[model samples]
Target: MVCKLPAVFLLVPGIFLACTSLKPVQQLSEEARRGLGHFHKLGYNYAETCTMDCTFQKVRTFTVDRRLNCECASYQKADSVVWGLFRAMEQYWMGLSELASPGLTSYDLSAPVQSLHASEFVSLSEGEVSAIQKMAEFAVNTSTGRFRSRRILHYMKDADPHLRLLTEKLGFVLEQNLLGLLEIQQEEWYTHYKTQTINSELNAMEKEWATEKHYQLVEDAEKIRLKVVSLVAMLDLIAEKHHSLAVTAEKIGSENFRNITAALSDELKDLYVVFEQVNE
Candidate 1:
Protein backbone atom coordinates (compact mmCIF):
# COMPACT_ATOMS: atom_id res chain seq x y z
CA MET A 1 0.00 0.00 0.00
CA VAL A 2 1.21 3.53 -0.83
CA CYS A 3 1.75 5.44 2.38
CA LYS A 4 -0.46 8.50 2.60
CA LEU A 5 1.25 11.72 3.70
CA PRO A 6 -0.19 14.38 5.95
CA ALA A 7 -2.10 17.20 4.37
CA VAL A 8 -0.01 19.90 6.02
CA PHE A 9 3.45 18.38 6.08
CA LEU A 10 4.94 21.04 3.83
CA LEU A 11 5.62 23.40 6.70
CA VAL A 12 8.79 22.03 8.21
CA PRO A 13 12.01 24.05 8.67
CA GLY A 14 15.59 23.88 7.43
CA ILE A 15 16.68 21.12 5.07
CA PHE A 16 13.88 18.83 6.18
CA LEU A 17 11.25 21.15 4.74
CA ALA A 18 12.69 20.59 1.28
CA CYS A 19 10.92 17.25 1.05
CA THR A 20 7.16 17.26 0.82
CA SER A 21 5.14 15.17 3.28
CA LEU A 22 1.75 16.08 1.86
CA LYS A 23 -0.36 13.46 0.13
CA PRO A 24 -1.29 15.88 -2.68
CA VAL A 25 2.33 16.55 -3.52
CA GLN A 26 3.18 12.89 -3.34
CA GLN A 27 0.32 12.13 -5.70
CA LEU A 28 1.87 14.19 -8.46
CA SER A 29 2.72 12.25 -11.60
CA GLU A 30 6.01 10.40 -11.60
CA GLU A 31 7.65 12.97 -13.87
CA ALA A 32 6.35 15.86 -11.83
CA ARG A 33 7.51 14.20 -8.64
CA ARG A 34 10.93 13.49 -10.07
CA GLY A 35 11.18 17.01 -11.39
CA LEU A 36 10.35 18.51 -8.02
CA GLY A 37 12.94 16.30 -6.36
CA HIS A 38 15.54 17.36 -8.90
CA PHE A 39 14.61 21.00 -8.47
CA HIS A 40 15.07 20.85 -4.72
CA LYS A 41 18.38 19.03 -5.12
CA LEU A 42 19.76 21.83 -7.24
CA GLY A 43 19.93 24.12 -4.23
CA TYR A 44 21.80 21.48 -2.22
CA ASN A 45 23.96 20.75 -5.21
CA TYR A 46 24.93 24.40 -5.46
CA ALA A 47 25.61 24.51 -1.75
CA GLU A 48 27.72 21.35 -1.97
CA THR A 49 29.65 22.71 -4.89
CA CYS A 50 30.19 25.94 -3.04
CA THR A 51 31.34 23.98 -0.02
CA MET A 52 33.59 21.72 -2.03
CA ASP A 53 34.85 24.43 -4.38
CA CYS A 54 34.64 27.56 -2.24
CA THR A 55 32.98 29.34 -5.13
CA PHE A 56 32.02 32.42 -3.15
CA GLN A 57 35.43 33.02 -1.56
CA LYS A 58 36.12 36.45 -3.07
CA VAL A 59 32.48 37.52 -3.18
CA ARG A 60 32.32 40.10 -0.42
CA THR A 61 29.18 41.70 -1.76
CA PHE A 62 27.02 41.58 -4.87
CA THR A 63 24.04 43.42 -6.28
CA VAL A 64 20.69 41.60 -6.45
CA ASP A 65 20.75 41.24 -10.24
CA ARG A 66 24.29 39.92 -10.13
CA ARG A 67 23.33 37.29 -7.57
CA LEU A 68 20.82 35.68 -9.94
CA ASN A 69 23.08 35.72 -12.96
CA CYS A 70 24.97 32.53 -13.85
CA GLU A 71 28.18 33.82 -15.44
CA CYS A 72 28.79 30.55 -17.28
CA ALA A 73 25.85 31.18 -19.57
CA SER A 74 28.04 32.72 -22.23
CA TYR A 75 30.52 29.88 -22.46
CA GLN A 76 28.06 27.03 -22.29
CA LYS A 77 25.15 29.02 -23.75
CA ALA A 78 22.49 26.41 -24.57
CA ASP A 79 23.76 23.81 -22.12
CA SER A 80 24.23 25.47 -18.74
CA VAL A 81 23.20 22.99 -16.05
CA VAL A 82 22.16 25.63 -13.58
CA TRP A 83 20.06 27.33 -16.19
CA GLY A 84 18.85 23.92 -17.28
CA LEU A 85 17.69 23.22 -13.74
CA PHE A 86 15.79 26.50 -13.75
CA ARG A 87 14.10 25.50 -16.99
CA ALA A 88 13.27 22.10 -15.62
CA MET A 89 11.54 23.74 -12.68
CA GLU A 90 9.56 25.86 -15.06
CA GLN A 91 8.45 22.78 -16.89
CA TYR A 92 7.46 21.10 -13.66
CA TRP A 93 5.42 24.12 -12.71
CA MET A 94 3.67 23.97 -16.06
CA GLY A 95 2.92 20.32 -15.60
CA LEU A 96 1.47 20.97 -12.18
CA SER A 97 -0.60 23.81 -13.55
CA GLU A 98 -2.13 21.62 -16.20
CA LEU A 99 -3.06 19.05 -13.60
CA ALA A 100 -4.40 21.37 -10.88
CA SER A 101 -6.31 23.73 -13.07
CA PRO A 102 -7.25 21.86 -16.17
CA GLY A 103 -8.88 24.11 -18.83
CA LEU A 104 -8.39 27.24 -16.76
CA THR A 105 -7.19 30.03 -19.05
CA SER A 106 -4.14 32.18 -18.26
CA TYR A 107 -3.56 31.00 -14.72
CA ASP A 108 -0.83 32.86 -12.85
CA LEU A 109 1.57 30.93 -10.60
CA SER A 110 3.14 33.73 -8.60
CA ALA A 111 1.08 32.71 -5.58
CA PRO A 112 2.37 29.13 -5.72
CA VAL A 113 5.93 30.37 -5.66
CA GLN A 114 5.20 32.54 -2.66
CA SER A 115 3.30 29.69 -1.00
CA LEU A 116 6.27 27.39 -1.42
CA HIS A 117 8.39 29.86 0.49
CA ALA A 118 5.78 30.21 3.21
CA SER A 119 5.17 26.49 3.71
CA GLU A 120 7.37 23.60 4.90
CA PHE A 121 7.42 19.88 4.21
CA VAL A 122 8.26 16.73 6.12
CA SER A 123 10.22 13.97 4.42
CA LEU A 124 8.88 10.45 4.02
CA SER A 125 12.35 9.09 4.61
CA GLU A 126 15.06 9.97 7.11
CA GLY A 127 17.81 9.09 4.67
CA GLU A 128 16.61 11.68 2.16
CA VAL A 129 16.63 14.33 4.86
CA SER A 130 20.09 13.25 5.95
CA ALA A 131 21.53 13.62 2.47
CA ILE A 132 20.21 17.15 2.08
CA GLN A 133 21.34 18.09 5.55
CA LYS A 134 24.85 16.98 4.67
CA MET A 135 24.91 19.34 1.72
CA ALA A 136 23.77 22.29 3.81
CA GLU A 137 26.43 21.54 6.41
CA PHE A 138 29.04 21.35 3.68
CA ALA A 139 27.98 24.78 2.46
CA VAL A 140 28.49 26.17 5.97
CA ASN A 141 31.95 24.66 6.40
CA THR A 142 33.37 25.50 2.97
CA SER A 143 32.42 29.20 2.86
CA THR A 144 32.89 28.97 -0.92
CA GLY A 145 35.77 28.17 -3.42
CA ARG A 146 37.09 24.64 -2.81
CA PHE A 147 34.91 22.73 -5.30
CA ARG A 148 36.67 24.08 -8.39
CA SER A 149 39.70 21.85 -8.84
CA ARG A 150 38.18 18.88 -7.09
CA ARG A 151 34.72 19.13 -8.58
CA ILE A 152 34.66 21.28 -11.70
CA LEU A 153 37.90 23.06 -12.50
CA HIS A 154 38.03 20.86 -15.56
CA TYR A 155 34.84 18.81 -15.32
CA MET A 156 31.97 18.26 -12.90
CA LYS A 157 32.83 15.71 -10.21
CA ASP A 158 29.40 14.64 -8.99
CA ALA A 159 27.95 11.14 -9.44
CA ASP A 160 26.32 11.91 -12.77
CA PRO A 161 28.75 11.97 -15.68
CA HIS A 162 26.46 14.19 -17.76
CA LEU A 163 26.09 16.48 -14.80
CA ARG A 164 29.88 16.59 -14.60
CA LEU A 165 30.08 17.62 -18.23
CA LEU A 166 27.45 20.27 -17.73
CA THR A 167 29.05 21.58 -14.57
CA GLU A 168 32.50 21.54 -16.09
CA LYS A 169 31.23 23.47 -19.04
CA LEU A 170 28.88 25.87 -17.25
CA GLY A 171 30.03 25.75 -13.64
CA PHE A 172 33.57 26.77 -14.53
CA VAL A 173 32.33 29.80 -16.44
CA LEU A 174 29.88 30.89 -13.71
CA GLU A 175 32.35 30.37 -10.85
CA GLN A 176 35.04 32.49 -12.48
CA ASN A 177 32.90 35.30 -13.88
CA LEU A 178 30.52 35.48 -10.94
CA LEU A 179 33.39 35.78 -8.49
CA GLY A 180 34.92 38.56 -10.57
CA LEU A 181 31.60 40.38 -10.77
CA LEU A 182 31.18 40.06 -7.01
CA GLU A 183 34.69 41.45 -6.51
CA ILE A 184 33.87 44.35 -8.80
CA GLN A 185 30.77 45.08 -6.76
CA GLN A 186 32.68 44.82 -3.50
CA GLU A 187 35.33 47.21 -4.80
CA GLU A 188 32.59 49.56 -5.94
CA TRP A 189 31.41 49.88 -2.34
CA TYR A 190 34.63 51.65 -1.47
CA THR A 191 35.35 53.41 -4.77
CA HIS A 192 31.93 54.26 -6.13
CA TYR A 193 29.77 54.94 -3.11
CA LYS A 194 32.28 55.65 -0.36
CA THR A 195 35.06 57.47 -2.19
CA GLN A 196 32.71 59.25 -4.52
CA THR A 197 30.65 60.64 -1.70
CA ILE A 198 33.72 61.69 0.24
CA ASN A 199 35.34 63.26 -2.80
CA SER A 200 32.21 65.14 -3.68
CA GLU A 201 31.86 66.58 -0.21
CA LEU A 202 35.54 67.47 -0.05
CA ASN A 203 35.40 69.19 -3.45
CA ALA A 204 32.41 71.22 -2.37
CA MET A 205 34.18 72.23 0.84
CA GLU A 206 37.26 73.19 -1.13
CA LYS A 207 35.24 75.39 -3.50
CA GLU A 208 33.61 77.15 -0.54
CA TRP A 209 36.98 77.73 1.11
CA ALA A 210 38.41 79.21 -2.08
CA THR A 211 35.47 81.54 -2.43
CA GLU A 212 35.65 82.79 1.20
CA LYS A 213 39.46 82.93 1.40
CA HIS A 214 39.41 80.50 4.32
CA TYR A 215 42.01 78.02 3.00
CA GLN A 216 43.00 76.43 6.32
CA LEU A 217 39.45 75.93 7.52
CA VAL A 218 38.48 74.59 4.09
CA GLU A 219 41.16 71.86 4.17
CA ASP A 220 40.18 70.85 7.68
CA ALA A 221 36.48 70.73 6.84
CA GLU A 222 37.12 68.72 3.65
CA LYS A 223 39.22 66.16 5.51
CA ILE A 224 36.63 65.71 8.23
CA ARG A 225 33.71 65.42 5.83
CA LEU A 226 35.56 62.97 3.57
CA LYS A 227 36.16 60.52 6.42
CA VAL A 228 32.66 60.96 7.79
CA VAL A 229 30.96 60.41 4.45
CA SER A 230 32.99 57.34 3.65
CA LEU A 231 32.17 55.78 6.99
CA VAL A 232 28.49 56.52 6.54
CA ALA A 233 28.37 54.95 3.07
CA MET A 234 30.13 51.83 4.19
CA LEU A 235 27.78 51.32 7.11
CA ASP A 236 24.69 51.90 5.02
CA LEU A 237 25.75 49.47 2.31
CA ILE A 238 26.57 46.77 4.85
CA ALA A 239 23.19 47.09 6.53
CA GLU A 240 21.23 46.95 3.28
CA LYS A 241 22.98 43.87 1.97
CA HIS A 242 22.68 42.14 5.30
CA HIS A 243 18.94 42.65 5.30
CA SER A 244 18.52 41.55 1.71
CA LEU A 245 20.66 38.44 2.00
CA ALA A 246 18.98 37.52 5.26
CA VAL A 247 15.56 37.64 3.65
CA THR A 248 16.70 35.61 0.66
CA ALA A 249 18.24 33.00 2.92
CA GLU A 250 15.03 32.72 4.89
CA LYS A 251 13.07 32.28 1.72
CA ILE A 252 15.36 29.43 0.71
CA GLY A 253 14.99 27.71 4.07
CA SER A 254 11.23 28.04 4.17
CA GLU A 255 10.65 26.86 0.62
CA ASN A 256 12.71 23.71 0.97
CA PHE A 257 12.41 22.87 4.63
CA ARG A 258 12.42 19.20 5.66
CA ASN A 259 14.07 19.05 9.09
CA ILE A 260 13.09 22.46 10.39
CA THR A 261 14.86 22.54 13.74
CA ALA A 262 18.40 21.72 12.68
CA ALA A 263 18.74 23.78 9.49
CA LEU A 264 17.38 27.19 10.52
CA SER A 265 19.95 28.12 13.16
CA ASP A 266 23.06 27.66 11.02
CA GLU A 267 21.53 28.98 7.81
CA LEU A 268 20.32 32.08 9.60
CA LYS A 269 23.77 32.69 11.03
CA ASP A 270 25.39 32.24 7.63
CA LEU A 271 23.01 34.79 6.19
CA TYR A 272 23.70 37.22 9.02
CA VAL A 273 27.39 37.34 8.21
CA VAL A 274 26.72 37.72 4.51
CA PHE A 275 24.28 40.55 5.18
CA GLU A 276 26.66 42.21 7.67
CA GLN A 277 29.36 42.31 5.02
CA VAL A 278 26.88 43.66 2.49
CA ASN A 279 26.01 46.44 4.92
CA GLU A 280 29.65 47.20 5.63
Candidate 2:
Protein backbone atom coordinates (compact mmCIF):
# COMPACT_ATOMS: atom_id res chain seq x y z
CA MET A 1 0.00 0.00 0.00
CA VAL A 2 1.40 3.43 -0.90
CA CYS A 3 1.23 5.72 2.09
CA LYS A 4 0.06 9.27 1.38
CA LEU A 5 -0.10 12.56 3.28
CA PRO A 6 -3.01 12.76 5.79
CA ALA A 7 -6.35 13.75 4.21
CA VAL A 8 -6.57 16.89 6.40
CA PHE A 9 -3.05 17.95 5.35
CA LEU A 10 -3.93 17.31 1.70
CA LEU A 11 -7.03 19.46 2.03
CA VAL A 12 -4.99 22.29 3.62
CA PRO A 13 -1.57 22.09 2.02
CA GLY A 14 0.27 24.26 4.58
CA ILE A 15 -1.84 23.40 7.67
CA PHE A 16 0.77 21.07 9.16
CA LEU A 17 3.79 23.03 7.99
CA ALA A 18 4.45 24.42 11.52
CA CYS A 19 5.04 27.92 10.22
CA THR A 20 4.69 30.89 12.57
CA SER A 21 2.02 33.37 11.46
CA LEU A 22 3.09 36.90 10.54
CA LYS A 23 -0.32 38.30 11.40
CA PRO A 24 -0.32 41.52 13.41
CA VAL A 25 -0.66 41.15 17.17
CA GLN A 26 -3.32 42.92 19.19
CA GLN A 27 -2.08 45.85 21.26
CA LEU A 28 -2.95 46.56 24.86
CA SER A 29 -5.78 49.08 25.26
CA GLU A 30 -4.70 52.74 25.42
CA GLU A 31 -6.48 53.58 28.67
CA ALA A 32 -5.19 50.52 30.47
CA ARG A 33 -1.63 50.95 29.23
CA ARG A 34 -1.64 54.68 29.99
CA GLY A 35 -2.92 54.06 33.48
CA LEU A 36 -0.18 51.49 34.04
CA GLY A 37 2.49 53.86 32.77
CA HIS A 38 1.12 56.71 34.85
CA PHE A 39 1.24 54.82 38.07
CA HIS A 40 4.67 53.42 37.27
CA LYS A 41 6.01 56.88 36.52
CA LEU A 42 4.37 58.41 39.55
CA GLY A 43 5.91 55.79 41.79
CA TYR A 44 9.27 56.36 40.18
CA ASN A 45 9.07 60.14 40.61
CA TYR A 46 8.14 59.79 44.25
CA ALA A 47 10.96 57.29 44.78
CA GLU A 48 13.47 59.60 43.15
CA THR A 49 12.39 62.56 45.23
CA CYS A 50 12.44 60.53 48.41
CA THR A 51 15.96 59.38 47.62
CA MET A 52 17.18 62.96 47.18
CA ASP A 53 15.45 64.18 50.32
CA CYS A 54 16.78 61.26 52.33
CA THR A 55 20.32 61.85 51.14
CA PHE A 56 20.08 65.54 51.98
CA GLN A 57 18.74 64.66 55.40
CA LYS A 58 21.63 62.24 55.87
CA VAL A 59 24.12 64.97 55.13
CA ARG A 60 22.33 67.32 57.48
CA THR A 61 22.42 64.67 60.20
CA PHE A 62 26.14 64.15 59.68
CA THR A 63 26.65 67.87 59.94
CA VAL A 64 24.79 67.90 63.27
CA ASP A 65 26.80 64.94 64.47
CA ARG A 66 30.05 66.72 63.80
CA ARG A 67 28.98 70.03 65.32
CA LEU A 68 27.45 68.49 68.43
CA ASN A 69 29.99 65.68 68.72
CA CYS A 70 27.30 63.01 68.85
CA GLU A 71 26.40 59.88 66.89
CA CYS A 72 23.34 59.68 64.64
CA ALA A 73 24.07 56.31 63.12
CA SER A 74 20.42 55.29 63.38
CA TYR A 75 19.36 58.18 61.18
CA GLN A 76 22.19 57.43 58.75
CA LYS A 77 21.01 53.84 58.61
CA ALA A 78 17.51 55.07 57.86
CA ASP A 79 18.88 57.05 54.91
CA SER A 80 20.51 53.89 53.59
CA VAL A 81 17.10 52.23 53.63
CA VAL A 82 15.66 55.12 51.64
CA TRP A 83 18.42 54.69 49.08
CA GLY A 84 17.69 50.97 48.81
CA LEU A 85 13.98 51.65 48.43
CA PHE A 86 14.61 54.06 45.53
CA ARG A 87 16.93 51.55 43.85
CA ALA A 88 14.21 48.93 44.04
CA MET A 89 11.72 51.42 42.64
CA GLU A 90 14.03 52.14 39.70
CA GLN A 91 14.16 48.42 38.97
CA TYR A 92 10.39 48.16 39.27
CA TRP A 93 9.86 50.96 36.75
CA MET A 94 12.33 49.37 34.34
CA GLY A 95 10.50 46.07 34.59
CA LEU A 96 7.15 47.80 34.13
CA SER A 97 8.37 49.69 31.08
CA GLU A 98 9.67 46.47 29.54
CA LEU A 99 6.34 44.79 30.19
CA ALA A 100 4.25 47.59 28.79
CA SER A 101 6.44 48.21 25.73
CA PRO A 102 8.60 45.22 25.04
CA GLY A 103 9.83 46.54 21.71
CA LEU A 104 11.31 49.68 23.23
CA THR A 105 14.98 49.29 24.15
CA SER A 106 15.27 52.24 26.55
CA TYR A 107 13.06 54.32 28.85
CA ASP A 108 13.28 58.04 29.47
CA LEU A 109 12.39 58.33 33.13
CA SER A 110 12.55 62.12 33.03
CA ALA A 111 10.01 62.45 30.24
CA PRO A 112 6.92 64.33 31.43
CA VAL A 113 4.92 61.43 30.08
CA GLN A 114 6.55 58.15 29.27
CA SER A 115 6.29 57.34 25.57
CA LEU A 116 4.13 54.39 26.54
CA HIS A 117 1.22 56.82 26.52
CA ALA A 118 1.61 57.64 22.85
CA SER A 119 -1.53 57.43 20.73
CA GLU A 120 -0.31 54.25 19.09
CA PHE A 121 -0.48 51.29 21.44
CA VAL A 122 2.34 48.78 21.42
CA SER A 123 1.59 45.13 20.65
CA LEU A 124 2.53 42.46 23.09
CA SER A 125 3.24 38.90 21.97
CA GLU A 126 2.21 35.82 23.93
CA GLY A 127 5.79 35.34 25.08
CA GLU A 128 5.99 39.04 25.94
CA VAL A 129 2.80 38.83 28.01
CA SER A 130 4.21 35.91 29.94
CA ALA A 131 7.44 37.84 30.44
CA ILE A 132 5.47 40.86 31.66
CA GLN A 133 3.74 38.75 34.25
CA LYS A 134 7.07 37.45 35.45
CA MET A 135 8.45 40.99 35.60
CA ALA A 136 5.51 42.17 37.70
CA GLU A 137 6.21 39.38 40.15
CA PHE A 138 9.88 40.35 40.26
CA ALA A 139 8.97 43.97 40.91
CA VAL A 140 6.79 43.02 43.85
CA ASN A 141 9.46 40.67 45.18
CA THR A 142 12.10 43.39 44.99
CA SER A 143 9.80 45.83 46.78
CA THR A 144 9.23 43.32 49.53
CA GLY A 145 12.93 42.68 49.81
CA ARG A 146 13.68 46.39 50.16
CA PHE A 147 11.08 46.83 52.90
CA ARG A 148 12.20 43.68 54.71
CA SER A 149 15.74 44.94 54.90
CA ARG A 150 14.76 48.41 56.16
CA ARG A 151 13.46 47.37 59.61
CA ILE A 152 11.70 50.74 59.90
CA LEU A 153 10.28 50.06 63.32
CA HIS A 154 13.69 49.57 64.89
CA TYR A 155 15.17 52.69 63.32
CA MET A 156 12.18 54.86 64.11
CA LYS A 157 11.77 53.76 67.72
CA ASP A 158 13.45 56.76 69.30
CA ALA A 159 12.47 59.04 66.42
CA ASP A 160 8.75 58.42 65.77
CA PRO A 161 7.13 60.24 68.69
CA HIS A 162 8.79 63.48 67.70
CA LEU A 163 7.83 63.35 64.02
CA ARG A 164 4.87 65.66 64.18
CA LEU A 165 6.62 68.14 66.41
CA LEU A 166 9.64 68.18 64.15
CA THR A 167 7.49 68.43 61.07
CA GLU A 168 5.90 71.53 62.45
CA LYS A 169 9.17 73.13 63.45
CA LEU A 170 10.98 72.22 60.25
CA GLY A 171 8.02 73.23 58.15
CA PHE A 172 8.04 76.65 59.76
CA VAL A 173 11.79 77.10 59.30
CA LEU A 174 11.70 75.78 55.76
CA GLU A 175 8.87 78.10 54.93
CA GLN A 176 10.60 81.09 56.49
CA ASN A 177 14.18 80.62 55.42
CA LEU A 178 14.50 78.01 52.70
CA LEU A 179 11.22 77.72 50.81
CA GLY A 180 11.62 80.89 48.78
CA LEU A 181 15.29 80.23 48.25
CA LEU A 182 14.52 76.75 47.04
CA GLU A 183 11.83 78.01 44.71
CA ILE A 184 14.00 80.77 43.26
CA GLN A 185 17.40 79.14 43.29
CA GLN A 186 16.60 75.48 42.89
CA GLU A 187 13.39 75.63 40.90
CA GLU A 188 15.18 73.74 38.20
CA TRP A 189 17.47 71.81 40.53
CA TYR A 190 16.08 68.38 39.77
CA THR A 191 15.93 68.95 36.02
CA HIS A 192 19.27 70.74 35.97
CA TYR A 193 20.97 68.02 37.98
CA LYS A 194 19.85 65.41 35.48
CA THR A 195 20.57 67.40 32.32
CA GLN A 196 23.26 69.95 33.02
CA THR A 197 27.01 69.57 32.68
CA ILE A 198 28.68 71.11 35.69
CA ASN A 199 32.30 72.30 35.52
CA SER A 200 34.58 71.57 38.51
CA GLU A 201 34.31 75.22 39.66
CA LEU A 202 30.50 75.09 39.66
CA ASN A 203 30.61 71.76 41.47
CA ALA A 204 33.00 73.15 44.12
CA MET A 205 30.80 76.24 44.55
CA GLU A 206 27.70 74.10 45.05
CA LYS A 207 29.55 71.93 47.53
CA GLU A 208 30.73 74.98 49.48
CA TRP A 209 27.28 76.48 49.54
CA ALA A 210 25.77 73.19 50.63
CA THR A 211 28.32 72.82 53.39
CA GLU A 212 27.67 76.34 54.67
CA LYS A 213 23.92 75.82 54.59
CA HIS A 214 24.21 72.48 56.34
CA TYR A 215 26.25 74.07 59.14
CA GLN A 216 23.84 76.99 59.43
CA LEU A 217 20.89 74.62 59.75
CA VAL A 218 22.69 72.50 62.30
CA GLU A 219 23.57 75.59 64.31
CA ASP A 220 19.87 75.93 64.86
CA ALA A 221 19.34 73.33 67.56
CA GLU A 222 15.66 73.08 66.65
CA LYS A 223 16.46 71.88 63.12
CA ILE A 224 19.03 69.44 64.41
CA ARG A 225 16.55 68.13 66.97
CA LEU A 226 13.98 67.51 64.25
CA LYS A 227 16.25 65.96 61.63
CA VAL A 228 15.14 62.42 62.42
CA VAL A 229 11.56 63.60 62.47
CA SER A 230 11.92 64.92 58.95
CA LEU A 231 13.54 61.67 57.93
CA VAL A 232 10.59 59.70 59.36
CA ALA A 233 8.09 61.74 57.37
CA MET A 234 10.04 61.13 54.16
CA LEU A 235 10.23 57.43 54.98
CA ASP A 236 6.50 57.28 55.67
CA LEU A 237 5.65 58.96 52.37
CA ILE A 238 7.88 56.56 50.44
CA ALA A 239 6.46 53.50 52.20
CA GLU A 240 2.90 54.65 51.54
CA LYS A 241 3.57 55.23 47.83
CA HIS A 242 5.32 51.87 47.52
CA HIS A 243 2.37 50.09 49.13
CA SER A 244 -0.06 51.88 46.84
CA LEU A 245 1.94 50.91 43.74
CA ALA A 246 2.12 47.28 44.81
CA VAL A 247 -1.66 47.23 45.27
CA THR A 248 -2.20 48.82 41.87
CA ALA A 249 0.11 46.28 40.29
CA GLU A 250 -1.85 43.48 41.95
CA LYS A 251 -5.16 44.84 40.70
CA ILE A 252 -3.99 45.05 37.10
CA GLY A 253 -2.05 41.79 37.12
CA SER A 254 -2.66 38.05 37.26
CA GLU A 255 -3.52 35.69 40.14
CA ASN A 256 0.16 34.92 40.46
CA PHE A 257 0.78 38.64 40.73
CA ARG A 258 -1.48 38.81 43.77
CA ASN A 259 0.32 35.86 45.37
CA ILE A 260 3.77 37.28 44.71
CA THR A 261 2.85 40.67 46.20
CA ALA A 262 1.14 39.22 49.26
CA ALA A 263 4.30 39.79 51.23
CA LEU A 264 4.22 43.49 50.37
CA SER A 265 0.61 43.64 51.55
CA ASP A 266 1.49 42.01 54.84
CA GLU A 267 4.42 44.36 55.29
CA LEU A 268 2.15 47.34 54.77
CA LYS A 269 -0.13 46.07 57.50
CA ASP A 270 2.82 45.78 59.84
CA LEU A 271 3.94 49.27 58.88
CA TYR A 272 0.47 50.62 59.65
CA VAL A 273 0.67 49.16 63.10
CA VAL A 274 3.93 50.97 63.61
CA PHE A 275 2.44 54.18 62.28
CA GLU A 276 -0.51 53.92 64.62
CA GLN A 277 1.78 53.36 67.56
CA VAL A 278 3.86 56.33 66.55
CA ASN A 279 0.80 58.47 66.22
CA GLU A 280 -0.42 57.47 69.65
The segments of candidate 2 whose C-alpha lies over 4 angstroms from its true place after superposition are 1-70, 102-280
Worst 10 residues of 1 by lDDT: 148-157
**lDDT values of the candidates?**
0.35, 0.36
User: In candidate 2, what are the lDDT values of residues 101-154, reduced to their tens digit?
Assistant: 433322223232223223235444445444444444344444443332232223
Worst ten in a row by lDDT for model 2: 20-29
Best by TM-score: 1
**What's the TM for model 1?**
0.22
**lDDT of prediction 2:** 0.36
Candidate 2 vs. true structure, TM-score: 0.21
**Which candidate wins on lDDT?**
2
lDDT of 1 by residue, 109-221 (tens): 33543443344543234444444444443333232222211222122112234322433434343344433343343444334334433555568765554445434434433
